[model samples]
Target: MKKWREYERLVSALTAEEYDKEYTVIPNARIKGFISQRKRQLDVLVEYRFNSDLNRRIIFDAKDRKRPVDIKEVEAFEGLMKDVGARRGFLICSNGYTKSALRRAQEHIVIKLLSSDQIDDISIGSWDMCRSDSCGDGLIMWDLTPGIIIDGTVYIQATGKCDSCGKFHIWCWSCGNRICIDYESELQCSCKGPWFWLTSIEPDCDEIGEQYESHYLILVLGNGNYHIMDRRPI
Candidate 1:
């Protein structure tokens, strides 16, 4: 576990430019606070900005345990992505993903599975060279809802408002669910209907009347307010 943390730290050190040029790291990354679901807190939340011309963003839920990634875990990550306005999402686990879990992730987001052996091979020197030098004194409360994560090589996710419905949505191509934003409560959608909470608005990357792309659009609603987040490029 310590080694995996070291690898993550090292990966975080590489700049977006360095990552793009060498495939070594992503940029503008940040560790997410504990995600509150119902009454529980998740393991880890990470966001990154990918070094792409389209400004791709991604978000992930990481667990440093030896157990296989599960379906519920992926669902939680999907919910988080919609809340944060991310285009893609991932579930990073220490032991790798299960076959069923992988299939489910493919339905909603891109999933990356890493073995303990693979974690051992990465170099740790990059982290030591890029440590931050300054610290400010204050209890900073960052709205994880609007921050991003860049893991040195790609954008984990981006948080913002949807272009069409002007609402915040989390677009997960894998789960086929679009999460709607609910500001009053952290919950993206509270609708009791199964698909009602999982539907999305029109995509922003292509013409509206033309063929719809294979991306999930999320519509967030709560406290009589509404908004949307389009996760597709076209």
Candidate 2:
């Protein structure tokens, strides 16, 4: 399993009825890539489309870790949403937020901090009616299975140590460039430039089929069906 799949699983376990009555969960909802003036690629752009009666959209960026989400990250997400013409945005992380980050988040956008326990609460199936886009039929479905697809790219900060070189490397799957920790180590590849086809799964859908959750970080590649490139717990 890839880290991204685990993110999906974690989100799949949330209870859908307690949240907004008209929140619909869409995993990996595509945000137009070319809209940005600088043309920056975004990771994990999930869309929460409200009921048809309410004409509004909520966007989210999920990070599966215990570290404090920095302001720069929030700024980047905000930029992406603004570029795509979205009015509201959220940053979801497995851990919590820093006091400074939380304060900063409140100043600009609607940010929600979720812990593993809260995530469990939503998964307990003890909420009200889910008003997301997919709840109209009264049939809710929770998606826990991992499904990998191609044609998606990711930008990752190098966090793991290389066994062969005994050094840290930052690899950007979107650009296919691997750099050293200090931005000094430069390794060039001749095969496919710096880009690598990464594989990851979309978040899981709640039983109500109203919301989707993020569980892990993943990379997507190719055009056909995709597969996980790294093994991690889900």
Candidate 3:
């Protein structure tokens, strides 16, 4: 379980540079434009921007397997690397790899295997490397300026009016979830899952614009997750 949490941080580490540079990459999701047309799910998908668009890509996959990885797995990953046409690929694992697996991975230099001990070698441009070194520190108090609420429970939220884009940003700290609003008043989770009681009628665009939207009503979704949406009316 901790490994998965760490894996998520690693995904953040892998994509943080692109994010800081204002390039977008999908996380914990499979990319669609690749060769197999959805053959695999990438933990981190880094897109390189050029000419004001994403033109090239790099990828990373974290395998938290209980047993040591095998050469067959490495071979499969190599094939995927070729199929995706990724500029570089890294396979970070919880356990070590087999000798044959290591040799097989090297046969395809694009894909390299990293044992648990080597994770510290990962280079992150912006996030303090020491922050991610601790799962609790890396996850619990993200510096995203989430609004915290306390009642029968403690929650986090980002619900309010957006000034420039002019939309509602919402969040729930207790559930550790938030909303990502785009054009119009339409909103969805970063996971892009169905909006389950995800939106409220009261906040109406006007209420958000007025900054009078009720916080308690907006923090907790029907699914019991926190929704953090930025409400800056510029």
lDDT of candidate 2 over 1-234, digit per residue (tens)? 355433543453242233342343443444343254343332232233211211144456667776878777777777777665455666777776676666667644665666666654444232122222323312123222223333353333222222112122334443554433321222333344333333233444333333322222223333333332221111
Q: lDDT of each structure?
A: 0.38, 0.40, 0.45
Pick the TM-score winner: 3
What ranges in model 1 sit over 4 Å off?
10-55, 129-234
**Cα deviation of 157 in candidate 2 (Å)?**
43
| Sequence-dependent TM-score of model 2 | 0.41
Q: What local lDDT score does residue 67 receive in model 2, on the 0 to 100 scale?
A: 82
TM-score for candidate 3: 0.44
User: RMSD per prediction, one decimal?
Assistant: 16.8, 17.7, 14.6
After best superposition, candidate 2 residue 104: deviation in angstroms?
2.2
lDDT of 1 at 209: 24
lDDT at 114, model 3 = 53
Count of clashes in candidate 3: 23
- What lDDT tens digits, residue by residue, belong to model 3 across residues 134-204? 12332221224333444445343433322112233345343555443333343445554323323333331
Global lDDT for candidate 3? 0.45
TM-score of 1: 0.41
Query: Tens digits of per-residue lDDT for model 1 on 1-234?
Result: 255445343333322223232121222223222233222222222322211112244544556666878878777777776544455665666776777777777655876665567656755442211111232211111111322222333222223322112233443332433444442224432323222223333323322222222223333333333333223222
